[model samples]
Target: MTALDPFTDALDCPLYVVTATAAGERAGCLVGFASQCSIRPARFIVWLSKANRTYRVAARADRLAVHLLGHDQDHLARLFGGATGDMTDKFTRTAWHPGPGGVPVLDEAPVWVVGRVQSRFDGGDHCGFLLAPEAAQHPGGDGVRLMFLKDGPDISPGHPAD
Candidate 1:
């Protein structure tokens, strides 16, 4: 393996539950590839796997909701990461409410942001959606430790990567 491969594999990054809505359909999935990409305009980039239902919905969605899952909320992570929406109604099983632009917001997420899609980029098997913040919610409480990718090693992706 290359030198970068091991380094990347050892990194522990926060996981997210990204949700989007379009054409009256809503979808969400677990995400490990996302970050604040810009500060001048305040942009966040969320990379969604092309093979996932959330990616399809996001393509036509005007906005998206990025949620921070607590370290103890692995069950929430499993719900979004372990099951495919193609055959399952994931939202119905979880607690969420419609946010800006009809995006589904996870009620349990301690911290969350609703952003309008500013642009999209082609990134091999995954696509990046640049978001401009529209709203943010931070429930004052203990700082919930973020769930990391390493924390969900057993979580089979809801959609297999191409």
Candidate 2:
């Protein structure tokens, strides 16, 4: 029981699927730590766990695609969040196309953005990737809600803590 655990445990925000490709290697993972970080310059930050395969590919990738999963897309969220790239080829199992800078864009996401990696920061076990959006697709919302952490209670993380 520490000061940070309370804050971290209480957060139940929207989930995102972050995809990236580098040197012909493709990777993606479910992300809970992503948000709009800037206003004037228009920047977003996505934090990837260092122990995940997506982070390894993202290290050499110049761009990434961030997707907002609808509440109904629980299976998609579980696939990305509960499966590890080291053992599962998530891209092949899902529908996607090569986006800007070879980043894979999930077709199921209601809203998505392709952005260039402008900067990176070491944030303990995870690293923050700052993105400058280059392109986006916002499908007309049909009252569909974004998926939240609490929605995926059955999902067991593919990459467990060390």
Candidate 2 is scored at a TM of 0.94
Return the clash pairs for model 2, or none: none
Show pairs that collide, candidate 1. Answer: none
lDDT of 1 by residue, 14-82 (tens): 989999999999999999899999899899999999999999999999999999998889888989999
Q: What are the RMSDs of all candidates, in order? A: 1.5, 1.3
Distance from true location, Cα of 41 in model 1, Å: 0.8
Error of 1 at 84 (Å): 0.7
lDDT of 2 at 147: 87
Where does candidate 2 stray beyond 4 Å? none
lDDT per prediction? 0.91, 0.91
Give the TM-score comparing model 1 with the true structure, all chains together.
0.94
